[model samples]
Target: MQYLPIFTKLDNKPVLVVGGGDVALRKCRAFLKARASVTLVAPEFCSELLEHASNNEVILTQAYFDESHLDGKMLVIAATDNESVNNTVFELANKRNVFVNVVDDQPKCTFIFPSIVDRDPITIAISSAGTAPVLARRLREKLETLIPQHIGPLATLVGSFRDNVKARFKHFADRRQFWEGVFDSSVVSKVQVGDTQGATAQLHGMLDAKAEPEGEVYVVGAGPGDPELLTLKALQLMQQADVVVYDYLVSDEIMDLVRRDADLICVGKRLGNHSVKQEDTNQLLVNLARQGKKVCRIKGGDPFIYGRGGEEVQVLAQHDVRYQIVPGITAAAGCSAYAGIPLTHRDHAQAIQFVTGHCKKDGQELDWPSLAKPNQTLAIYMGVLKSPHIQAQLIKYGRDASTPVAIIENGTRKEQRVVRTHLGDLAQQIEQHHIVSPALLIIGEVAALHEQLAWFGSSAQISSFAQPLTDVA
Candidate 1:
């Protein structure tokens, strides 16, 4: 983190602003909002600053800023138009160990203001470490729309009952469960309709009952490598989960979105290695849920598509564990779009097939004749190790050896690489490039689109695999 995000209490704290123009006036107002005792030192004051001074809200001094102005201040802001003055103020204040902000100058700042979504006592602050102020403001504006106005009131309502609930339930866990039930109950609706008395009554009744917390599971797909590809519902459940159970396929970026306090457990599943066995993972989920915890079973790609989500969900069903399935963009679709290779094209491919390179434990082989048919695209997941066998079987089943193929490594991620070659050289290209797991194979005429329509990778990386397809016998 470039800037450690923290909330500072400025109430009754002394703060200094070293400017007099509109910018200084603006900074002073922020301090005033936090009920800080603000003092501004400038040659002249803006009309707004004069108004604030007249109202006894701020102390204004008609003098040029100097080191003396840094006296006994907890925080300082240099919002001046003069760079030299701002620099001087920063150096003096910083040397004195006072938190300082030089407006519009990120490098000179020890502290910076963030875009805030203020809902009274519920304040949301966002900052880009002064690198991108406009972006942060845009995000705050977007949040303004999504956050309901009733939340502030709801929090106030709940805060009023904290003592009563605490005294009633001795344990912290019991109190949390009571509040969770209160929120889930009609008390929220009563609060929304301005029925504070009714809401308070309902809350009291729930606390008296001392209801047990119910556990559930969120089967969320983390999507193929890209964090942005995650569905809205998936993101919501991830943030709300109390415990996160994930696999190796889930990207670090996706895991970062899970609830900060959530307990994280990695039930590793790799091509050949298993950190935690499948049966054990299922039983673990069941056990965790029975403990009344919200478990987030996060996986890469659509959980149902080669993710073994169905098996996990079936286990959950058999145990009667409550769960919500949230789908994500599968690698077949995500990697294809990112690599500029359309899975199904009007002229190149009329049908599409999703395949996995790994066979089941029972050694069930793929249907080569059906997969080898023409005018179709095959999206092979985890097919790197079996490229030779896959290439040989398809070719032997009447598929043309000259059919184009694209191997996407780290698909949909920033470091993604595309290696374009023909079917006869599928295994050769994979070996030549040292491709790794979590790679996807796009096979068919449509794979040629990678060169024509490629848009995601860097220029050199995209153009590196531009070898022409040669007819193979």
Candidate 2:
């Protein structure tokens, strides 16, 4: 970020303004609003400046700009028309380590004022680092309309009871939960209706009741490598979750959206490498929920697809734990759309089969007869390791060796790669290109349509084998 946004307390602090014109007057008023002791230095004073001085709102000095005026001042503003004067104030302030703002000069200013939406104690400041001040102002205007007036009073009322709530709930998580529960209850409504006494009573009663916090699990699909693909419900659950249980497949971008305070547990599972066992993950969820924690089991792609969300939900059900399932865009759908590859085409494919390369008790073969059928697309997840077996089985089952295939690695992401080749060279291309996990394999004539509908990233075909084609990402 160009500038880190922060609120400074300037109440009763000394501030110097180096102009007596309207611009200086405007800047001086800002300091007065912050309850700062403002003094303006200029040879000539504007009518508004004279009025302010008469009312004792600000101290006026009838003199030219001088470095002596900057002494004992917490902040300095050069609002004069002279360029040299503004530059001098900027350099001098930097040497003295005092925050300075030269009006209308972005580069000269050490600090810039932001467009603010004030609601007494609740103030929202928006800035674009002086690069787009008008845009920032527009954003502030939009926020002004969206934010309700009742929010300030509600916050003020709740703030009064903060000491009581803090003493009641010893833990940080418990206090947060209490606040969340209070907001979800009718306390907010009472405040909205201007019933301060009733709201206070309700809040005190709820706090004294000491109700046990309910625990629930949210089975959310994070989608394939793209944060934007997340469902609204999934995002909501993730933000409110007390704990987030994720794996390797969930993208970093998606993980960033989780609540900042949420505890993260990685149970990442890759081929031949398991950070945490599946059974252990199930037990962990159950244990956490039993302790009154809201757990978010976030998975990549649709949870019910190849994501193993069903197994986790079944365990939660057996433990009598409450849960909500939110589905996400699966790999085949998201990756294909981003790669410009249609999973099913009118003339090329009539069906799609979602398959997995690995199964329980390894080497247990899939029904190759039905899989090898013509005019059907096979979206094989986790099939990079068993590409040779897949290629051999399909060819051996009377399926043509020249069948088109597309391997999408890190699909729907900026670093996504699409390696297109025939089914005969599926395994060869994977080895040659050093293709990694989190890749989806699309096999069938529909895969060939990638050439015509292709758009997205920069990955090209390794070798078409039957027919040479250009890049597809």
Candidate 3:
């Protein structure tokens, strides 16, 4: 937080660059990209800089750094290889109170360049306050892969409708809510998938629909980490979600799938740390929906399975608020499948059961005997820390000490890891792997099948297994 992050509109601003070498060329190019009228002050210019000046893109002054160059300049950049010259430029710019960046000299700089990811109207700036430029660039590259190329065009589409949206929703909050709804709708997705016509059609439908103040809530399941695993209904609700209240298990990759403009609130619950209380989260959704906003109560896995989706829905119902439940790929099922373990197998397990490892109160009793049935498959959610206790109970309740178990950490995510062991050694195995939360524990013979069924280990493998996107008539 050393530098205040901002997107300065440089259009029609005069920017001075003091240098003629490679460093100066880069600064000049950046200024041009920002739509700044650049003036390069140097005794000589490089081939690239000369060409830019010749093309009338930049005004080149073949002269040494001077205070006169600071006149009428909104911003200045000193990129000369000569340290003394760069220092002189910094002093002159500071005297004029103009923002200046001395390349590679953080102490002398009034501002610093950031690693930029440009999607035209959609620009992502990554900076480490001039401490780590290489790390910033690396992060920028990683982000480039996650963000789709069509985002720029999609941003432009949103920009085009800004005036219309403002005209329709006069209140500041109302306009914010309207744009959030538009982002979650098919309009943005269609544009992202290169269907501009479809996007326009959907947007027009929204605009023509009678304006109403009634809001609703969609308790959406974000699915186990992977965005593609989301259900059609879940995806639909996400597209129309005015605000998304998400949990900790939801990955950044999955969150990125959410409409860019939608207000995202992290109500994620972590072990021993409650950032947003359950009751408060429920009320937040209730309050927003009452304001006629489409609220997406996004959670990891199926909403009904330990997701507290039912409770949120109950609150909505009590207040007579309209709501829809969008089922997601629950962690137990998704982790099992991705790890090549089936929750149920005809020969090994005739029945499958899902149970929570922890209770609302400490030391609460659970049906240990029934859960330890030899022929049943058990998937325990939020049970890693209690694995030893769970194993002891099951072993005491007729289950064999050597019953197979598998731990899937960060299940269905890019960094997912799976460890297989017997019930007696499952706790030791978890500790050895340093398996963390947002994981699933499977106990029974079916857990042994993970080695045979594991497939989503690599991006290429996953891509090959994915079903092709088909056109619906």
Winning model by TM-score: 1
The estimated TM-scores of all candidates read 0.62, 0.59, 0.55
Report the C-alpha lDDT of model 1 over 1-473, residue by residue, as the tens digit: 87888898999899999999999988898999999999999999889999999999999989999898898999999999999999999999989999999998999999888999988778999998887899999999889865767779989999999899889989999888877777755466456557899777767767777534457788998889888888766876787777999988888988888889999999989867888899999999999988878889999999999988999999999999877888999999999998888899899899999999899989899999999999999999989999999999999999999999999888887667778899999999899888887899999999988877877444665553343222121
Candidate numbers sorted by TM-score from highest down:
1, 2, 3
Candidate 3 structure quality by residue, lDDT tens digits, 1-473: 68998889999799999999998998898889878999999999999998998899999999988898899998999988898999988888898899989988998888888888889888999998888888999999978866767779988888888898878878999888777777655455467557898677667667766444457787888889877788766766676677888988888877887877899989989978989988998899889987767788888898999988899899899999877777888998888887888888899999999999878877677899899888899999999999889989999988998888888887777667778888988788878778889888889999888767766644566564343211110
Candidate 2, superposed: residue stretches over 4 Å from native:
1-210, 457-473
The clash count of every prediction, one per candidate, is: 0, 1, 5
CA-only RMSD, every prediction: 9.4, 10.7, 13.5
Tens-place lDDT per residue, model 2, 1-473, is 76788898998899999998989989999999998999999999999999999999899999988788899998999999999988988899889999899999898777889999987678999999999999999999978865656779988999999999999999999999989888755566456557889778878888998545546688999999778888766876787788999999999999999999999999999878888989999999999888878889999999999888999999999999877888999999998887678888888889999999888876687999999999999999999999999999999997898999999888887677778899988998999888887899999998877887765423453231222233432
Off by over 4 Å in 3: 1-212, 457-473
